[model samples]
Target chain A: MKQKRHETPLEAIDRMTDNSVVFVGGFGRAGVPERLVEAVCRRKLRGLTIVSNNAGSNVAGIASLLQEGCVGKIICSFPLAREAVAFRDLYDRNLVDLEVVPQGTLAERIRAGGAGLGGVLTPTGVGTDIAEGKPLIEIDGRAFLIERALRADFALIKAYKVDPLGNLIYRKAARNFNPIMAMAADWVIVEAAEEVGIGALDPEHIITPGVYVDAYCAVTRIDQMMEATP
Target chain B: MTANCGLSLDQMAWRVAQELQDSWVVNIGIGMPLLVPPHVRADRDVIFHSENGIIGMGPEIEGGDHVDPDLLSAGKRPVRLMPGGSFVHHADSFALARGGRLDAAILGAFQVAQNGDLANWKLPGARTGSIGGAMDIAVGARRVLILMSHTTREGEPKLVDRLAYPPTARGVVTKVFTELGVFAITEDGFVLEEIAPGVCADQVRAGSGAQVKTDGATLMVPPDPVSPREPVLSRA
Candidate 1:
């Protein structure tokens, strides 16, 4: 196995290119890969597609990318919030494309991608606008819409702890989209708060194993990273 | 606003809390439904599920320097977890809902059609709106209950004969709890189950855009309201 460790976020983000499909993990303000996203912003990549739960807040994270014109389209569950003005303005002006998937559907699509499934058949968003353009198959007379699997060229994730081997563990609910996204991306770059010894992280307790990780950056203080201005 | 004419914000939350049965896993929506957890009965083993992955959610952390950014509700507010609380990844968390493991989902709504159609995600004429988890929770949960004001901010009735706004889900709402009364959506239409104290059936009918059947209406006795007790700051 090659050494999957980077000394800095910029070194980890060097492989990214224009028009790449990216998965940015986080649920709201928590578990955001701040330094990695900052590096993406500085790289000034264009026509990128961002897949996440919600669009980033107005001031930082994905919001900075939208302001910098780095994104061409955003595929997310919820893109509207008081702090999500950056994406909302771009959406209203028709400058960016928006694909709104239900939260469950979004998660399942990514899961299917990682597991190499063709698609997911779910009852969510049935009898509504979400079912309008999709094929509805009835299994045992129960309606389910077909949602295609979503994969990405790169994934930016945050973890609470990591070992030398790239195994990861996340804290509390911050573990939202990181684990699944790690599996679905061609190159998974993680920013962890702490780096423990090789034998420190228990094998059974690891949420993400070393095999899925391609590169990683370790931060001393997650708070300072979160509080940084974009 | 007059004496006991309708339920206050706290009273509405208290009433919704009473509907939660023991051992039932419930997903509470963001706004008014967030208040329900504070009023839940002590004896009931209700598990509060946040779509963000918390299985046994507790109330908001009162005060301390120990606020963990990772320990947050789906609403993005700081919160605590119960003794048995556990977390999962996003996919597994939503699997609990989409797989029909959640007992009930109580949410706030913009409008509800007489046939139990929900329209909460988008408003009329809005270019874009957030769907969040409403669509998935509405269709997946065993029972979907709505908690909101009887009318809009302009005093327009929200219970309408047909929805002008886009529907979140069709024929999914099982019950609606508003300030004016409790309503059950049935085969016939909107049935007035219980009227709020100091409010009459005629008032409910007049306030509703859809026809309200009040033949079996009864007076409601809501639980007493109790605000969450936080630590009081003392000045030296």
Candidate 2:
């Protein structure tokens, strides 16, 4: 097995291009790849599609990209918040496309993509507008709507710890969407707050195994990144 | 202002807390439902789940000095973990919701129709709605309870005949607790079950945008507590 490449945040994000579908990992600000997001903004890539839980809030993170008009569309569960002015403004002007999904369905779809499944059937949006135009199947006389798996060209994730072999463990609620997105992306770049030796992470505690991660960069300048808006 | 005419926000939260049974796993949404945790009966063992991933959530950390910067609720506020609390990933958190593990979900809403349809995620003419986890929790939880004021900030009734805005889910709301009264969705319509002190059925009917049924039923008044306790701040 090849060792996981260690790259700078800039070098890792440089691999992304225009119109790429990127899965960003974070719940609010807990597990966001701050440096990677900053690098994406600096690169000025446009017409990109982003999948995440929320459009980054008023603080930093993906909101900077939204402010810069780098994102053409977003597939997310929570697309708006009082603090998400950048997203709200862009959306109001028809500058960006938004597909609002239920949170559970969103997670399942991403997980399915990673697991190589055709699709999963869920009852989440059966009677709501979310079910509009989706195929409905009945099993045992119960209704379920088919939700396709969500895979991205690149996944920008944050982890509490990453071993040189690329295994990951997350801290507290920060674990949100990072683990699953790691599996579903063509290239996974993680920003780990701390990087340990290959054997440093215990097998039982590993949330994401080494095989899924392609490249990782240590989070050196936490203060500068964390100070950015949500 | 009608002095002491209805339940205060805390009183409404107190009433909503009364509805929960012991050992039930509950997901509390933003706004009024955030107030439910502090008011729950101390004797009952209720596990609080935040959609962001932490379960067995306790009250907020005091003074903002001791807060763990990484620990936050679904609402993005600092919260303490109760004993036996565990964390899961986002997918698993929703699984707890979608897999029918959550016994009840107390959510806030913009409008609740007589048929139990909820219109809380969006308003009319908004470019994009913040659906969040409303639809998932609305349909996934075993029971859906809505906590909101009877009227909008403009004093317009939120209990309506039909929704003017997009619904979070269809026919999911089981009960609605407002400052004015407790309304349950019946086959007929919204039936008033109880009234707060200083408010009568006629007042509730007049304030409601939809018709309220009060036939052949006595409207019981909620007991007035000597003093409402200060609610423990948990999540924002």
Best by TM-score: 1
Instruction: Indicate which candidate wins on lDDT.
Output: 1
What do the candidate models score in CA lDDT, each in turn?
0.87, 0.84
Candidate 2, B137-222: lDDT as tens digits? 89889889898888887777899999988888888889999878789999999998877777778888878999899665455455
TM-score of the A chain in model 1 = 0.95
List where candidate 1 sits over 4 angstroms from the true fold. A222-230, B1-4, B62-64, B223-236
Weakest ten-residue segment in model 1 chain B by summed lDDT: B227-236
Which candidate gets the maximum DockQ versus the true structure?
A: 1
Candidate 2 lDDT over A1-230, as tens digits, reads 66565667888676789999999999888888988899899899999999999987995998999987789999998887778888888888989999999888899999999999977899888877788999999999988999999999999999888888889998887888999999999999999888888788889999999889988888854532242111
How well is each residue in A84-188 modelled by candidate 1, as lDDT tens digits?
Answer: 989888988999999999998999999999999998999888888889889999999989999999999999999988887899999888899999999999999
Per-candidate interface C-alpha RMSD?
A: 5.4, 5.0
